[model samples]
Each structure stands twice: as structure tokens, then as C-alpha cells.
Target chain A: SAVISQKPSRDICQRGTSLTIQCQVDSQVTMMFWYRQQPGQSLTLIATANQGSEATYESGFVIDKFPISRPNLTFSTLTVSNMSPEDSSIYLCSVYSPRQGGYTFGSGTRLTVV
Target chain B: AQSVTQLDSQVPVFEEAPVELRCNYSSSVSVYLFWYVQYPNQGLQLLLKYLSGSTLVESINGFEAEFNKSQTSFHLRKPSVHISDTAEYFCAVDQAGTALIFGKGTTLSVSS
Candidate 1:
């Protein structure tokens, strides 16, 4: 099992600003994923970050808008850029565990853009 | 590609009553099934998963799910629920250790 510590639990930001949410895992992991959960909606994958490679984003998401950084096996960050009210959501980081056949997730960073 | 459908958006049940959260999936190949629970203001926690072998999988907290391959369904059930069981539950699928494809989620509201 991996424990992830995410910083800035909740933040209120102005529109057009950017906020970087960091996720630090206790163990080394091959892949880290970022997700968004809007109010009254299910989680949607934003991107997948692998150490030492460019992040792979899902449909309707782009690196320019939600850039990701995976500096090493145990750490990753997701930046929400050019924020808007529509972008206000809970951003989460998850790491897949093959042995467990599941993913361990961070507590999530709640963002409110005004 | 894979997709999961959690038929019920919300389920309200009285405490100590049986509850079932239905989940169905669509996939062209073999897949793994998982159930996750999310409490208020927290990240999702794994409830249980079906990888291989027996079709029935049980979680520590008395939650169980039956994997019916023919129907492509993995519905979560608890014989009796508690007030603490009130939370959003998600059903997900993955093929060969890939990223999980999640359902829309079912909100289980266990009340008195």
C-alpha cells in the first residue's frame, strides 16, 4: 500500500491564475495519474504521468491547460492553469498497484476559481 | 476500450437493511473489476476487487460483489448496512493492469 500526501488541501484562486498541487508517495511507483471530480459528477482522468517522460493526457485535456511533472518515482505535480469557474473541482492523484490490482489515491486538492 | 455503468445514481436505505449497488461493464476482452468507497472529504478507498478464480469477492466490512461474466456485471451488496456505510461508491474496470475506467458512481445514503 502506498500513502500519498497532497499539499494545499483546499484553495480559492482568482481566474487566470495557476495553482500547482503536489503529490508525494511513500513508495516508488511507475505511473501517476491526475483526475478531476466536479460537483455532482464522477471522476474524470486528466492525465497520466510517468517519471522521465511527457505526460499522456486524456481526451478534452491538454498539457498546456493542465501541465504535469513527474520528477521521480515517488513524486508528481499537476498544475491547473488559466483557471475558470468551470475549472473549479477537486483534483486528485492516484498510483496503480499491480499487486493490489487497485489504485491508491491522494486525499485531493479542492480548487475554487472565482 | 472499457466502460462501466452504475445504474443507480442514488440509493437511500434504512440502517440494517440489505442494499445492492448495481454495476455493469462493457469490454471486448478480459477485465478486472473493483469497488471503491469514498467518504465525505476523502479520497477513494478500495473496497474489493475481482481478478481471477472465485467469482465472489468479499471485503472486510461485510461488502461483497459477485462477478458474473456472462452478464458483464459486478454488483456490490451488503446483507445489512450501517449508518457509517453512507458514502459514494464507484465501480471500475481495467484490462491487463492499465488505468481504471470508472462508472459515474452511486451515492449510498444509509439513514436511520
Candidate 2:
């Protein structure tokens, strides 16, 4: 099992500002994913962070808005840019499964925009 | 595209009673089904998963879910409920080991 850690467990930001959430895994994973959960909603795949390449974002999410960086295996970051109250949600980092058995998740960053 | 459907958005049950959380999915090809639990102020943890072989899977905590291919369902069940079981449960489906499409999530509130 891999131990995943996320920085800034939570933060409240002002509108128009950007907040970057970092995810660090104890071991290298085959695939790393980012997810967003809006209040009273389900988890949505935001993007897939592949090391040394551009992040593959899902439809409705743009790199310009949610830039992702995977400096190396085991380390990744998701930046929510030009934040608005609508951007307020919980961002989570997850590892693709059964390597750690099922899916291991980071604690998540709870961001609230003013 | 694969999608999951959790019929109930919320379910309230008295502690020690039986509870069931329904989950259904739509996928043309083979897929993996999973149940996850999220406690307050915490991250989601996998409750169980159905990869292959047997259609029945059990979690360590006495939670069991059956994979009904004909019905396209993987519903979670616990014979007895507890206040500690109050949490948000998510049903997810993944085609292969790739992306996962999650259901809206069902909040299970077990009260005393």
C-alpha cells in the first residue's frame, strides 16, 4: 500500500487568486489522477497527470484553468487558476488501483473561494 | 462511456438495523466495479471491488456487494448498521484500469 499525502489540507482563497495543491506518494504509481467533488455532487475526473508530459484533462476542464504538473513520478500538483466561488470544492489525488489494492487516495484539499 | 447510478441520494436507518445501498452501471465492455466510503472530514477509502472470478465480494467490515452482470448492478449491503457507518458511499465503474466514472454518491446516515 502507498501512503499518499496532500498539502494545505484545506484553504480559503479570494476570488481571482490561484491555489496549487500538491500530492506526494510514497512510491511511484503507474497512473495518477486528479478529481473534483462539488458540494452535494459526485467525484469528477479533472485530469490525468503523466510524468514529463502535458496533463490530459477531461472535457469541460482546461489546462489553462487547471494546470497540472508532474515534475517526476510520485510528485504532482494541481493548480486552480483564476478562482471563483464556483471553483470551491474538494480536490483529491488518487492512485490507479490494486497496485496498492483498490484505490489509495490523498486526504484532499478543501478550497473555498471568497 | 461508462457511468454509475446510485438510486438513493440519502438513506436513514436506525442503528443495528439492516441497510442496503443500490448501485447500477452502464458499460458496453467489461469493467471493474468498486464501492468507496467517505467519513466526515476524511478522504474516501475503498470498501471493496469486483475484478473477476466470483460475482460476490466482501469487505473486512462485514459489508458485502454482489455483482449482477445481468442487471448491471453492484449493490452494497450490511446486515446490521451502526452509527459509525454513517458516511457517504460512492459507486464507481472503470473500463479496464483507466478512468473511473463515479456515481452521485449516497449519504448513509445510521442514527441511534
Candidate 3:
């Protein structure tokens, strides 16, 4: 199973500030997805990061507000641009690990904006 | 495109009791089903998945679910659950090699 490590497992930030979350996969994955789980809500797809290309974001999410970068197949980063209280949520990155028989998710970045 | 529907927002049960979480989906093409568990303040872990084989799948941790094609449902069940089994469970569906669409999730509470 591929192990995914997300840096800054949790953070508290002020509104208008930006936080960058990084996901590192032990093995190269063809597809990597970024999701945001609002408090007590289901996980929502934020974007799909493709190696060496611009990310494809889902509807209701914008490239300007949630910029993504996939420098390589094994690593990606998502940055919350100009955060707000409404952006407080858990951000996670997952990669398909055949050995895991499912997707392997990062520990998640718990963000709190005040 | 695929979408998942989890009928229950929450379920309460006692230790050593049976529990079932219902899930349904709508998709035009054949899709894969999966169950994921998230403990408190944690990331989701794969519980089990039904890709192409048998409709019934079991997790290493004693959880099981059956995929019903006719009903478009994949309900999770546990005969006798432990306290550790309580968590937020999500049902999702995806194409053979595509991304997944997750349900809202059901919060299972196992009491003493």
C-alpha cells in the first residue's frame, strides 16, 4: 500500500491568510485527488492533480481560490488562497494504491480559520 | 457520472450488537463500490470494496457488505461489532478506473 504523508497535520490560521498543504506519496500514482471535508459534512472533491499539468478542479471550486500544483506523480500541493472562516475544514489527498485495494488517504490537514 | 446516497445520517447500537448501514447509487455504467471508515478526527481508511468479483466483500476487521446490482445498493453489516467499529462510514462509487463520488456518510455510535 502506498503511504501518503501530509505536512502540517493541523493548523490554526487567521482569515485572509493562506496555507499550503503538501501530499507526498510513497509510490507514483497516476491519479491524485484533493478533497475538502467541512465540519460534519461529507468530503467534496476540490481538484484532480495530474502530473506535469495544471489541475482540473470541480464545479463550485475555482483555480484562483484553490490553486493546485502537481510537480510530479509522487508529490502535489494545494494552497488555499485568501482563506476565510468558511474555509475551515479538513483537507486530504488520496492516491489509488492497488495493494491497499482502495485509495490511500493522507492523514489530512485540519485547518481552522478565525 | 455517479452519485451515492447513504440513507442514514447516524445509527446507534450497543456493543456486541448487529448493525447495518444502507447505501444506494445511481449510475448508467457499471461502477465499483466501496466502504470507508473514519475514526474521530482522522482520515478515512478502506473498509472494503466490490470491484468486479463477488457481490459480497469482507474487511480484515470483521466488517462485511453485499452489493446488490438489481437494487443498486451496497449495505454494510457487522454481526457483532466492537467499540472500535464506531465511526463515520462513507459509501462511494466509481468507474472501473476513475475517481469516486462519496455519500454524505453515516456516523455509527456504539455504546456500552
Candidate 4:
């Protein structure tokens, strides 16, 4: 199983500010997924980041709002731009590991917009 | 496309009692089913998964889920749940080469 280190487990930001959450995997992976879980809601896929390519955003998610960066196979970052109260949620990164036979998730970054 | 449905939003049970969390999914193609547990302020952990061969998959923590292809269901069960078993359980499904689609999740509260 690959270990993931997510930075700034929790953060608080102004409504107009932005926050970037980083996820580092112990091993390289082809794709990384970003998900958002709003208060009392289910996890929703934000986008799929592939190394050296533009991210593929889900239906409701836009690149302007939730920008994703996959510089390499082992690392990715998700940025929440122009945060709002509604944007406050738990952001998680995941990677599918063939050796683990499952998806490995980051600890998650809890964001609060004030 | 794929989607998962977890029948219950919450399940309250006494310690050492049997419990079941129902899950169903709809997908046009063959899919893999999985059960994930998320403890308070923690990341999601894979409980068990049914990829192929066996219809029934068991986790190391005394939890098992049976995949019923005809019914399109994969319900998780524990014969005797401990207090530590209390957590939010999510049912997810994915096709051969896609991201997982998760359910709303079931919050299991076990008390003594």
C-alpha cells in the first residue's frame, strides 16, 4: 500500500481567498482524483488529474473554481479559488494502486471559509 | 456511468449485535464493489472489495459483504459488531478503468 501525506490537515480562509491542498503519494501513479464532501453530504468527484495533461473536471465542477495540478505521477495539488461558505468542505485526494488492489486516499484537508 | 445507493443514512446498534448495511449500484458495464469505512476526522479505509471470482468478500475486521450481480447489490454485514466498529461506511462502485462512484454513506453508531 502506498502512503499519502496531505499537508495542512485543516485550514481557515477568508471568503475571497484561495487555498491549495497538496497530496504526495509514496509511489508514482498514473492518475489522481480529487473529491469534495460538503457538510452532511456525500463525496463528489471534482476532477481527475493526469500527469502532463489538463485535468478532467466533473459536470458541476469547473477548472476555474477548483484548479488541479499534477506535476508528476507521485504528487498533485488542488486549489479552491475564491472560497465561499458553500465551498467549505473536506477535500480528499485518491490514487488507485494496482499493488494494493484498491484506492488509497489522503488524510483529507478540512477547509472553512469565513 | 455508475452510481451507488446506500439504503440507510444511519444505523444504531448495541455492542455485540448483528448489523447490516445495504448498498446497491447501477452501471451499464461490469463493475467492482467496495466498502470503505471513515472514522471520525480520518481518511477512508478500504474494508473489503469484490473484484472477481468470489461473491462474498470478508475484511480482516469481521466484516463481510456479498455481491449479488442479479440484484446489483453489495450489502455489508457483521455478525457481532464492537464499539470500535462505529464509523461512517461508504459503498462505492467502479468500472474496469474509472474512478470510484461513492454512495451517500451510512453512519453506524454502536453503543454498549
Write down the TM-score for model 2.
Answer: 0.96
Clashing pairs in 4: none
* Per-residue alpha-carbon lDDT of candidate 3 for residues B22-83, written as tens digits (9 for 90 to 100): 99999998988999999997778888999878889999988899999999999999999889
Runs in model 3 deviating more than 4 A are A98-101
Give a tens-digit lDDT track for model 2, residues B12-59. 999999999999999999999999999987888889999888999999
Score chain B of each candidate by TM-score.
0.99, 0.98, 0.97, 0.98
Model 1 alpha-carbon miss at residue B18, Å: 0.8
lDDT of 1 at B109: 99
lDDT of candidate 3 at residue A17, scale 0 to 100: 93
Q: Candidate order by lDDT, highest to lowest?
A: 1, 4, 2, 3
Which number leads on lDDT?
Answer: 1
Off by over 4 Å in 4: none
Alpha carbon deviation, residue A20, candidate 4 (Å) = 0.9
Q: In candidate 4, what fraction of native interface contacts survive?
A: 0.52
Clashes of 4: 0
What's the C-alpha lDDT at position B69 in model 2?
97
Candidate 1 residue-wise lDDT at B40 = 83
Question: What is the C-alpha DockQ of each candidate?
Answer: 0.70, 0.72, 0.65, 0.70
Candidate 3 is graded, for docking, as medium
Give the Å shift of residue B10 in candidate 2: 1.2
TM-score of each: 0.97, 0.96, 0.96, 0.97
DockQ-based ranking: 2, 1, 4, 3
